[model samples]
Target: MEIKTIGVVGAGKMGNGIALSAAMAGYQVVLQNRTAANLVKAKNSMENQLQKLVQKNVVTAEESAATMARVQMTSTFEKFDAVDFVIEVVAESLDLKTAMFIQLDTMCKKEAILVSSTSTFSITALAAVTQRPPQVAGMHFFIPPTKLVELTRGYYTSDETVNQAKAVAKQMDRVCVEVKKDSPGFIANRIYTPLFLEAFKAYEEGLASKEDIDLAMKSSYLPIGPFELADIIGLDVLKSSLEYYQSELGPSWSPPLSLKQLIRAGRLGKKVGKGWYDY
Candidate 1:
């Protein structure tokens, strides 16, 4: 299927990044948020990012302006009617995502491909709640949406759905990693979550400071340390994912006490100006 127009639900960091990515790739993007304030924030964030791209010479000023022109921001699903593709990038709550999926199913055309950017949720479960299972799949983009896009097929997702998602990813100039299994966390998080948990455990046990632990990992093979990554991801988000992992896997996957305490204290990470480390 030809995906010329893309709709991104939610306009926070991830949502805006996805909108920017699609627009940069020449797709007309309708970025939807929950409120007018969010729409304004998303627009400002996209503009700032475009300015950075222009400054870095990744794109000329004319190209940046054209890309910005392609993205339309909204606070409702009105634009989704003509959208050929819809991606829900809402928070990782299952109930919230399911609700959004159901809304997308109702608002979009039957042939419109529906995708979720959830990192640790089941695409199968989300698809089951929709009327168009064959058109539903997982297109998990990394936090920045500039790294890799994971194209995944749920239990009921069709080959056509998978292929169309791949095409969409290629159009965005992203490297595609096909996730065969419909399991929670897909591929990256299966490896990532363990490393994150171990980092928390190590810190909680006083084996190392968060700074030193992150330093060690970065010194070895990673671009950033686990605690630092967790902070960027939001401590609340990491704790929530860890809690989900514990429920799905076992008690051993329970979130560390240190994480819970930080969350309880409202230190949600860089967005909030505090988390594993102060920003």
Candidate 2:
């Protein structure tokens, strides 16, 4: 299907970046959040991103404004008319995602696709909850969609839908990795989980300080090590992924307990200005 208009389910960093990229790609983006407050936050964040694009000369100031103008912010499903594809990026709970898909199946056009930005969870199960399973698929973007290297596919995704997503991704300058299944931790998460867990395990076993481990990885020419990267991504997200991984896999997926206590105390990562490394 040729996508003309795209819809995003959440307006957080991931959703907003996806929406901004869609707008910059010259597609109409319907940015849907549950509340006016969320819509406002998205708008402000989007404007800030656009301004940065302008400052960095990535886009002309006029183009920045025009790209942002292509976005339509709304707070209800009623605004989703004519949507070609919906990328659901809300909370990662399976029940909530299934419920949202049930609602979306009724609301969107018959041909429109329903995609989840879930790192973990069964897309087939999610599709089963919806009326149109063929139209339901996983369109997993990485943390930032604009910098997307590739996205994984769900087991049940149709060839046509996958192609459509691939074409859209290419148009937006992204690579696509079609994963075989949509189980918890599709592909990247599946591979990343063990690496991150081992990092936590290293800490738990008293191998070395978080700083030294990170330094070793960086000095060894790896992108970023576990603890430092976890600090970059909030501990809460890791907590959620760990729970999902543990539930699906086994004890090996267990995150370090200290990480949980930190999250419990509300000291998330970079967002909180504290983690294994202060940032």
Candidate 3:
């Protein structure tokens, strides 16, 4: 099916970023969140990012304005009926995401494609909860979706659905990597999550300071070190994802005790002004 207009659920970081990318690609975008305040924040954040693109000469002023005009924010999911595609970009919780998929499966047109932006879970489990398993797949976007994305076809996902998702990603100027087989963490995270866990382990064991380990990695091949990225990802989120991985992959992916304590202390991450380090 042709995807012209797109609906994005959740107005958090990933949701807003996806909306911005889709709008810049000339798609009519409807960004949805459960709260009005988040919808406002998402709208303002997109405008700020668009203004930056204008200032950087990436997009003309007129182009930026037009892109902004193409995006609309709402708290209701029913407004997405006209959209040709819908992408769920909520938190990393499996139950919550599954509920969203089930709801979207019922709400969206039978022909309208549905996908998830989950970075931790397999699309198979999510698709199993929906009636349109053939049209459901995982479209995992990197932090900034303009760069890279992963398209994972669920066990029952059709080739047509994968091709349509790839086409949509291309239109958004994103390079799509197909995960031929469904893996626990997909491609990128399967490699990186373990390393981040090890980093936490080292710090927890007092092998090195968090700063020292971060410095060591940054001094080598990585852009942002694990702890910093953990803060950016939110420690609670990191802890929860690790717990999920540990359940599936064994102790190697075990959530660090110190990390759990930090989360228990209510220091989430950069969004809350503190985590591994003060933000």
Candidate 4:
């Protein structure tokens, strides 16, 4: 099916980025969040991001305004009934995402494709909750949304669904890598999670300070240090991903002690102004 209108759930970092990209790509976008305040914040955030793009000459002011105009922000899922595609970017909780998928399946048009921006969760498991399992897939976008988007297929996801999802990612100007199997973490996270585990373990074992480790890695080949990246991604998110990995991968994937301690103290990440590093 041709995708003309897109629905994005969870107006947080990932959600807003996805909505903005779709709007810029000339698709009518419906960005939904449960909280009105979050919807406001997301709208303002998109405006600011578009302004930055304008300043950098990545997009013209007229284009940016037009992109912003294409997006419709809402607090209700009812608005998604007519959307041709729905991307769920909610928290990485299995229960939360599964529930949302069930709701989307009930409310969205039967032909609408449902996708998730999940990093580590199983797309097949989520598809199981919906009647249109063949239409459910994973479209995992990175933090910034400029990098690669991993397209994953659930056991029942059809070839047409994968092609349609790839089309959406390409329209958003993102490179796509297809994961043929229904696996936890797919491609990027499957490899990156182990690196995160080692980094956390090193810090916990006093092998090196996070700063030193970050500097060492950045000075070498990485654009950003693992710890810094973790903080930016949210320690809570990191811990949750780790827990999921441990359950699916092995005990070695368990979150480090220091990581858990920081989360217990409520230092999530940059959004909260504190994490492994202060903001």
CA shift of 31, model 3, Å: 0.7
Better of 2 and 4 by TM-score: 4
TM-score of each: 0.96, 0.92, 0.97, 0.96
Give the count of colliding residue pairs in each prediction.
Answer: 0, 0, 0, 0
Count residue pairs with overlapping backbones in model 3. 0
The regions of model 1 sitting more than 4 angstroms off are 144-146
* Predicted candidate 2 versus true structure: per-residue lDDT over 13-77, tens digit per residue: 78887888788889999999888898898899889988887899888999988888889999898
With a 3 Å backbone cut-off (N, CA, C), the pairs that clash in candidate 3 are none
Rank ordering of all candidates by TM-score, starting from the highest: 3, 1, 4, 2
Q: Note the Cα lDDT for every prediction shown.
A: 0.89, 0.81, 0.89, 0.91
- TM match of model 3 to true structure: 0.97
Provide the global lDDT of candidate 2 against the true structure: 0.81
In candidate 4, which residue pairs get closer than 3 Å at backbone N, Cα or C atoms, i.e. clash?
none
Question: What tens-digit string does per-residue lDDT give for candidate 3 at 1-279?
Answer: 678899999999889999998999989999999999998888889889988888999899999889989998888878777888889999889899999988888888889889998888979999999888989899998763348899998999999999999999999988899999877889998999989988988998899999999999999999889988888888887777888888888987888888988888888989899898987
Q: What tens digits encode model 1's per-residue C-alpha lDDT throughout 1-279?
A: 688999999888899888998999999999998799999988999899989988999999999999999998888898899999998999888899999998999999888999999898889999999899989999988863457988888999999888888888888888999999898788998888889889888988999998999999999998888888888888888878878888888998888898899999999989899888888
lDDT of 4 by residue, 1-279 (tens): 789999999999889988988999999999999999999999999999999999999999999989998999999988888999999999988889999999999999999999999998999999999999999999999984456999999999999999999999988889999999878789888888888888888888999999999999899988888988998888998888889988988898888899989999998988799998895
- Candidate 1, TM-score vs. the true structure? 0.96
Ranking the candidates on lDDT from highest down gives 4, 1, 3, 2
lDDT of 2 at 17: 78
